[model samples]
Target chain A: MNYNWNWGILFEEPYFDWLVSGVEWTLFVSAVAWIIAFSLGSIVGVARTVDSVPIRAVATAYVELFRNIPLIVQMFLWFYVVPEMVPDDWGRWMKRDMPFPEATSAIFCLGTYTASRVAEQVRAGIESIPVGQRAAGLAMGLTTVQVYRYLLVPVGYRIIVPPLTSEFLTIFKNSSLALTIGVAELLYQARQIENYTFQGFEAFTSVTLIYLVLTMIVVALMVSVEEKTKIPGYGIQKDK
Target chain B: MIMLGDFDFGVIVTALPYLWDGMQLSLLLTGLAAVGSIFLGTLLALMRLSSIRLFQWIGAIWVNFFRSLPLLLVIFWFYFLVPLIVQGQVDAFESALIGFVLFEAAYFCEIMRSGIQSISRGQAWSGYALGLKYSQTMRYVVLPQAFRNMLPILLTQTIILFQDTSLVFVVGLADFMTSAVTVAQRDSRLVELYVFAALVYFVMCYFASLSVKILQKKMHK
Candidate 1:
């Protein structure tokens, strides 16, 4: 009840700059990580459903390993433990010379972790295509690789757009965890402002709104994609 | 200077007690929050399903508001805001617990809502035909079936809650992950401790997920 509320402090010179930089880092992490997730997830998801047993097992292992561990733990493992586990020169580079080591580790961590979830969605999207679709593709004299390239990948990606949008949004949220390892992302900057100004409420409130807005923007963009790429009477349309 | 050859899981052996204590707290938080959220979630789900417009709005807002923000932010908000509101210091652990329960209740609400909806309307109508009140039908007939239907998903969500308990590290809670880091720091054995923690989590969550997969398969049949 005795709290001093200062809404203006958030827009103050250094704090405002901090907020912008924080958002820049957050977007950077999420965007880069998403590239990794989308690519790796596609490969892994396809691998899981492939006819090759060993390939399927390897993809399943990849998903299980990454998905089972907590993101923070994975982040810590990547940032702290991984350097030591590698050779000495690589560890030195990671610790000292690599560009934005904290952020880079975070990108990889979030990327691989989300990739597992994305892989699941991708597998679901692909699997939902009906056995007949795969059979028909094969029956049409298409090779397995050709079938995926020409038919499955394009259609499967479209089918899973909604889930992928949420996954992309999640990477942004997960990027906040990078702060634990000293990445100056949005959440980290919010805490920095709170530390300097003691305006914890305002700092957090602003950051929360920023995250919500970011999420809304992603939803809007993806919804457009969904609308543009509407497959006539195929793929499940989940209620928003 | 450390190499893969230098990996000494002996650190885990030495730090087992601390890690065990931390694991206990982690499990305790996950268990408590899971149970609390399910109860709150059930209420919210019912409210959303209720014919009353105000209850439906309240339920919808609660779920959407929490879902829209990151859990970490919510935890930070509770940790910082509650002290100011009460004009007193709030325990970090308690704040984190409150944050987890409230935030997780939102997710559980959606799950429960879907679970309830999945139950055929005819079943509810049958209960109504048997001279039962709306509340009675939900209590005796609808909820039990919903719980049965969603047990695997509930367990899967609980596993996620267990993983999430590690996030309390930001607020200085000595949960399992934090404990491993603590020991790793004090002993200067970061590699061993982190890998051990990852393995522990991997073992528990992997098997749990596998079982959930099996349950899903069985249910499908």
Candidate 2:
């Protein structure tokens, strides 16, 4: 019990700024990456359900490749190997002129990695929809594209709101892997604070609490969305 | 030709012994964490399902707190904080193992909870009709079925555990990723070393997941 508790150092200048910017970067990386994950995941997921062999094969390959590797390794590859693989000009730009290279690469790595997981959810959501609905739409003279667009996609997305919420939270947590590539996110800032003040306990505790708060907010928002969009007697909603 | 020029298979050949040593440590951590988490997680899941209010609250909080935070943060907490609490030195390997087991238990707890709940109520009622106590009924009747149902999902989670074992590098543990980084830095062949490591991971996880899929299909049939 020789340690002196100095929780006050957190409020000091530069330290506070580190935490603020850390939160900003963490949120920025997660939010932008979420957009990529959802969009790409939806496309790949829908493709997986399609009849075309090539499209399905490519989508499955993307999921297998990205989902199998660890996020940190992928981030490192993006940070290091990808630059060398590209043309000399683009490589130089990535290393030099590209802003927030670590963040950008982290976003890509996290996005695509989580996209595989999200794609699984999206595919499951779409598959869960009754086949009769798709058949009904098609039987009414709607094109396959229009049938999916107007009938299936909207309902499938609504049905998946709960799993999507968990996925959203997972992406936020996974964003912490960005620290390996030096993304200066919340976890990185916590490490910096610990290094500077030797207050590892306080720094990590606060950051963990901040993350808990972020996830709680997300859960609450998604809960409200789920309630509003719920179709009667369809999806799993436990009645109290 | 340019791709072939950048890669030095000789470097990987030379680094094989070191990488093998690291892979052993990674596998050891995964096995240890997997067993420890499942045991602890099953307990938490049972507690969450218990009729007692206090037990349920404690289990709920533990699962929620761990589930909310990142694994890296938990690893850091153990690496820095455990030594202080124990009044002795805790090495990186032990700290990382403890962190993974505890953090992963939260996930395992949720999975086990769902698995337990998936069992039909009639199964438990039948045990009661046989004059079995609550604990005995759970042990003999309900748990075996739940465990069977959860086996593939548990194995899938272990595949994920194998991928996450790489995170030990953050605590300076000489796991597989750390070994790769060491070889890459020593020989200035970062690209080749990383690509090789990524391939190893991808192959292992991909095959394991494929087996999980097969098992899932077999079980359904």
Candidate 3:
């Protein structure tokens, strides 16, 4: 109960700059990683629901492989092990020559790992549509790809808003794992601030607030997307 | 595109005993946290389902707040913040353990809530027709069925908890991940040791998840 409290330390010169940069890196990494997750997840998800047995198997294997392992472990693998497994020159490029090697690996790791979860959301969305919808689309002379583009994509994505909302926010939370590999993100900066100022409470409090605000922003964004993309008579959304 | 050199199986072989000890710590954390969260989580779930708006809001806030934060942040909070609040030093293991329980409780509460909701209203009504009170209906009819239906999901979450024990590495708990990193650094066998660690986790969790799937299939019938 006798610990010193200092909220002012956060606004000081170097620490302030550190925190600003930390937030930048966090937003940068998570936003770009989300782009990868959504794109790859949509493809893998559609592939799983396709008629090609081998494609389904590959997609299923990708999901299992990514989902079964811990993200921290996968981050380490991409950061350390996977780079070493490549050709020597490329390994050097990844480990030494690459720009922001740690952040780059972290983006790759978080992107692919969360892609598996997003794929599940996407898959659930697609599969939840009535079978008759797919049958009807095909019966109307639409090719499989055209069916997905017109009917499935339009309806399926809307149905998955609730689940995908969680998945979207999860990418932000999981970006904190970048600290393990020395990405100077929010959590890492919080630790650094604590180390410098001996104000662990103040440092972490700032981070906690930043993260809570970040979550709200993400939720609000998803809510808007949900409202905009909502299909009539789908999902749990109540209508007027 | 992988070169095949600079790996020493000897390093992993020699570190086996130490790694085993670390594995025990990881399992211990998962076990203790799983048991602790289940009780707290079930209580929270009941609170959410209860008629009192106050209880419902408290449950909602607890789950939403914890679920929004990173697990790493929770670990840091327990380690750094709790000690200052209590004015006493909390060991890394206990801090990590408490963090896991509280954080996982949020997830468990959600699962339990849905499990409770999944039951047909007719079942509770049937109990009412048989002259059961609300508490009696929940205890004797609804909860038991919910637990049975939720067994596979609970097991799957436990598997995830096992994988998540690795996050304690940041706080320097000597869990399996820390042990792997330590040996990988000390013996200079980064690729080999890390690959082995990931393989061990993969085998354990992959099989655990498969079994959960099988249980789901059996429960389906």
Candidate 4:
């Protein structure tokens, strides 16, 4: 049976609102999760490199545990299991009083999951720097914290712009998983549009275009950042 | 108080056969998809690196498009769209396998391209100096070394592909995740089953990653 494609149906009132809000929530979820990933990953990543053995081991274990588990399972555990695990009143509060609880849980899950990835990047970035710099900082009487804060972090972050850019794109794609937990993001909206209209192809096609556009924008932004912050010889070259 | 009686290992023991069946399907998909994508990805990498503009454009567009989109969306598209394209009823298993191979070919292509390009230009030039054709040089000289160099990364990606196999649950395939969910709901022990599933996933993935690490160290050594 041939299918009659009505691309215009996506632009209709209710469907259009679904798509728009889907985009908004997708962006909102990814952006907030990125902030969480960056901050938490930075701490954990720095801790991994610290002189303290116990701190480093704990950080490493955190990365391994989070990194190894699939994100969807993590989302389920966070969404369905965690609330039930908590105190009775808190669980009720989560179910009732929490605003956009699904979104909150998705953010938490995605952020922490991506944080494991980001932590690895951060650790690699710091390690990529010359050991002499750390020695130089110490020679100048800077404490370890001051050394990382003033010297290692700035250079390492810059050095890792390319990887971080890829990580950002990854988180955006991963945000799609939030749909499984009923966040009504782009994929979820597309599924809704499909269920409503039986126009699976069109719904998925439009949302795929939005994803492509989002990733392109991220690529462009990150490339420009890479260009501006690139050190003379440390930046990645295309054919080198 | 959460009672120990509520958490039943006996239920998990009963569900083990079905869950294991699902795990087999998941592993089968990952294995097939890995082989297919690696073969196709290698071809795409060669096309991208080819001198022909048309080949380069085709390779670039395919890679970029799939790379830009989420794997879930790709799975959805193939699940719904391929049957229409092929004018035949494609089973859920076939659709998921096709979607995975196609989508992952894009990523694997990029990885293989980088691996191939990482070989020094002089190596390719020496092939030319020996009067070997481009394809022969690639087949004989370049690809072997490139594959060896890229084995660790390729395995790491395969582990990721293994994790991603769980996404097949979206299409209603009885993969591990879906099977666990089914059993959990059927048995009314969501917590125990999910926890068990997560443990299974974590153990497998952690071991795979550890192997990749070991492989990387061996290669470096």
Each candidate's interface RMSD (Å, one decimal) is 1.4, 2.4, 2.8, 2.2
Q: Using DockQ as the measure, which candidate wins? A: 1
DockQ of each: 0.73, 0.66, 0.62, 0.58
Whole-structure CA lDDT of model 2: 0.90
Candidate 2 residue-wise lDDT at A90: 89
C-alpha lDDT score of every prediction, in listed order: 0.91, 0.90, 0.90, 0.91
| lDDT of residue B8 for candidate 1 | 84
For model 1, residues B19-116, the per-residue Cα lDDT tens digits are: 99999999999999999999999999999999999999999989878887888888889888898888888888788889999999998998899899
Residue-level lDDT of model 2, residues B74-152, one tens digit each, is: 9889998999889899888898989999999988988899889999999999999999999999999998999999999
Give one digit per residue, the lDDT tens place, for model 4 in A74-111. 99888887777778888889879999999999999999
Q: Rank by DockQ, highest first.
A: 1, 2, 3, 4
Clashing pairs in 3: none
Clashing pairs in 2: none
Scored against the true structure, residue A11 in model 1 reaches a CA lDDT of 83
Off by over 4 Å in 3: A236-240, B1-6, B122-137
TM values, all candidates: 0.97, 0.97, 0.95, 0.96
Q: lDDT (0-100) at residue B10 of candidate 2?
A: 93
